[model samples]
Each structure stands twice: as C-alpha cells, then as structure tokens.
Target: MDDFRLFTSIRYDPELLKVPSLGFTNVGWNSKSSPFHMLDFHRDRMLRAAIYWDWTAAIASISGQEGLENLERFLQGATKDLVNGPHRLMITLARDGSLGYEISSLPATHLNNLYPEYLPNQSFDSDSNISVTVRGGKVPIKDPMYDIFVDSQRTTKSEFTHYKTTFRDMYNDARNRAKVNPGDKKEVLLLNEDGYIMEGSISTPYFWRNGKWVTPPVPRKFDAFQGSGGNDGTTRRWALERHLAAEETVLADSLVDGEECWISNGLRGFICGKVKLH
Candidate 1:
C-alpha cells in the first residue's frame, strides 16, 4: 500500500484525452466483444466533482483554459474494454499552478519497485481478510513526511489533502502502521484531535451508528489532526444524495456502537468488509 511513482508524466497531450470515435457510448458499448464491460461517462462527472470540491482554482487561473479539459484528455486514452478492471487515474496539481495527470491500470500482478520491505504483505484481491487499524492516538508524520500528511483542514492545508497531489507519505505511513497487525489489507483509520474517526488513508470511512449511516464531517477549521480532508469522491457524493449516508462527526469512542463499517473511494465503491478495532 506504500505509494510510489507508477507512470511518468507526459509533457502535454490533448489527443490523449479524447473519447474514442467508435467505442462505448452512454447507452452501451460499440462492440459486443467485451460482454462484461460497463460504460461510465466520467468526463463530465469528474469535472463537476472537482469544481464541487473547489479545486478548479488552478485550472481557472490559467489563461483561456477550462478546468475540465485536462481530465477529458486523461479519460480519452481509456478506450480499452477493461472498464471493470482495477484502474486508477491520478490528477496532480503543483503549488506553482502547474498541473499534471496520469491514467494507468493497476498491474495484474503485484510488483514492489520501492519500499519492498517497509510494510507487511497484503493481498491485492478485494475480498480477502480486509480490516483497518484505528490510530491509537494522534499520529503525526516525522520530518520529511510531515507535509505528506495534511495536518490541517483549512484551505491552506497541504496540496495533497485538497487535490491528489504527488504526495503519498501519509498513506505510506498508514500502510506501515497497519503492517504491525495482521490482515489481508489493513487500512489506517485516522482520528482527529477530538478522537473522531475521520477517514481511512485512501478512503472515506462510513459507519452505521445510532440507527443511521454517517460519514465524518469535512474539516473546515485548522485542526492538529493529520489527514483531515477526505477526498470529495464520487461515491461519497452518491451516498449523500441518495440519503444513504449523512455527514456527521463519528467519535472514536462510538465506533464499537456501530452496526457495521466500510471504506470507499472513487475507483472502488463501498468495500465489502469491516474494520476490526481490537
């Protein structure tokens, strides 16, 4: 789960973001060759999602450019029938108003190019022995990794928290901590200074507590808690809109009072597993 560079950035390619001329449409796929494929028109959805999170400032600041053009370019290259496959698209923005993005599929096989021994082994398979670790206390990153984790929820927070910048120090640190325990894939559940369960390292945490499902509140003020800003993911939005979940502060002490818990991200919807807090 340690984050590392997967693909090098391409200088600038508009053609890479174009939709295929004869491929999947909103109604259905162009070909029946891939029967199990699903078509999701994500370009517009992605742009709207970014704007909702107020992350389009950098793109807007650019001269004669709309914020969504780059995302269109990023999705244009995903013409393959592997829509159901575990692929990840990353959009990174620099502090200097520079933007970079990459779209790539997760390798079918596990490959550890860096930090091979930094964390315990975890199965890539989704359903196998999934769990999450509750941070025993306020865990802050040291020296070089300090900025990797967002210590504040304010607009001035780390770029990683607001946008998926090229920073994975917080996630990597969480994975390392999870390795101390045993599970197929143990994520780190970060808590705020008030001991409220905020989010997982790479996911938004949800719980069924007090007869309703709720997600941790989005941090709006400066808090010493690291990893405060949860990604404004599509799944989170869906759950909120459909009345499936409400935004509320989930205290760590109330975790045991929940009926069940799960984590979600844009790439992967609700994970079908629970976090064992022992």
Candidate 2:
C-alpha cells in the first residue's frame, strides 16, 4: 500500500497567490477565500502521473469536482490543529482513495520582495464561495538564500525523475553522494548522462541566461536512453505561465561559478541564489 500511494506537497498560506484566470480563488489557511499557490497545477501534474502509471483508483481520487471537494474537506480537517502561520502541506492518496496529510510550519520567504513583477497581487473577491477554518498569519519577512551545487555523478532518467512520488531512492542516493554537512543550506543539482542539467534534488533549477531566467526543459516523451528531463514542478509552471522564465535545455558545462540563479519548490516560491559548479 505504501508503494502504491501518490503524493504532493504544497504551500498553504493565508495570503493568496492570486490566479486571475481561474475566475475564483482557492481556499487557504485562515482566509475565507484565497489561493494555495498553484493548487490546480499540482493536482493536474499528479493526475497525469497517475494516468501514466495506470493507477486508476488514484486517478479517480484526485480527478474532478468530487475529488476537489474531498481534498478541501481533508485539508480543512487536517488543519484544524494548526496554529496561525504559513505551512508546508504534504498530502498523499492511496489506491483505495484514502487521503493522508502532514503539516509543518515554514519560515516566511522573500518571494514578492525579490521578484515583485512576477508575483500577483493579494486580491480576493468577496463573492468567493470556498471557505475553510484553517488559521492564518502574516507571511514571513525573513529572506533566506541557498547555495547550489552540481552533482559529480550523473543520474539515469526514469519515471521517478519525472514524477513526484514516494519512490525517492534515486534522489536520496544523489543527496547522499553529495556528502553535504548537517544544517547546510544547499541543493545538489543532478545532471543526465548526456550532460544536460536536469534539476535539484528537491527543487527546480532556473538559470539566468541571455538576460532571462531559463529553466531546463522537461521532455514529455521519456526515452530510456535519452534525458528524462526534470520534474514539471508547480513553481516552474507558475514562472512559465507568467513568462517570468523560459524553458530551454541547460547543459551542466554552461553553469558559471558564482552566477546568480533561482530555485523553487511548492513550499518556497521563487528564491534568488548563486551556483557552484564542480
């Protein structure tokens, strides 16, 4: 059962990450109506992976209106015990449609402060119907940065590299190989056998190239012998949707030492950082 469950982690905050195209906002912690970063995008990504893996029951658990309602209910119940603050909400679904979640507090990020042009304004319509009882608080103001490292070894691309799941042995092994010291604020970027930079172990990599933010292209078709591309991360999707970043093939050799770049995940939005190539 553990091996069959699909999962995703998302940012749950009282402050909304607005989505004007949706015409309605998603419920967030403590807000009567708001957004959960890129909730729909995350759901769609998981749904696609489920379809690819032929997990019919898992697909049904996260697919349409019913699934959305069920997810809201689960989140509402799970967040009842939470305190007023932003959180990292990790949700998992079983093959039998059972849902589980874990909530952890997160320090505020400088996403809006660092990239104001890319972030949407915090606006919500009073007519929004979605509501939840989760607690809310101010977004943290402490800006944290990370040190990025290029892995010395190349990883073979596979379904695990392209999808977000519990099957994380490859990623774990990559991190282990890096031998990072405890409490190190760093991420190890993995490369493919063909020398294409894939992604960070737990975040999406965005390089500043030709006067624009460019991320490694994620290939739709998986070729065992070719690069599997990187995971289609929600943060990357958000950046691409807003034209804040472009998708291009990034070669490991192209990375410049101490060059400014960015990395992101569902928990943290766009983060400014620098690269360290081996």
In terms of TM-score, the best-performing candidate is 2
List the candidates' TM-scores in order: 0.53, 0.80
Clashing pairs in 1: 17-73
Supply the global lDDT for candidate 1. 0.41
Residues 1-278 of candidate 2: C-alpha lDDT, one tens digit per residue: 34656788977765544333322222222123543656666777778777877777878888897876667777777777765668888888766667788888876654342122342111321221212221231121213556788888898887778878888777777788886553467888999889898898888988767767788887554546554368878777767775767888898888888876677788776655568765
**Residues 1-278, model 1: lDDT tens digits:** 23321111211222212223422222122122221111222333333333434545533533232534444343454434444434555544433334455566542211111001111111222323222221221111111110112222212234344334345666556656655232234456665545666567666666665566678765332233544455444445545654657888766666552234555554433443344555
Alpha-carbon lDDT, every model: 0.41, 0.67
TM-score of 1: 0.53
Note the clash tally of each candidate: 1, 1
Cα RMSD of all models vs. native, in order, equals 12.9, 8.5
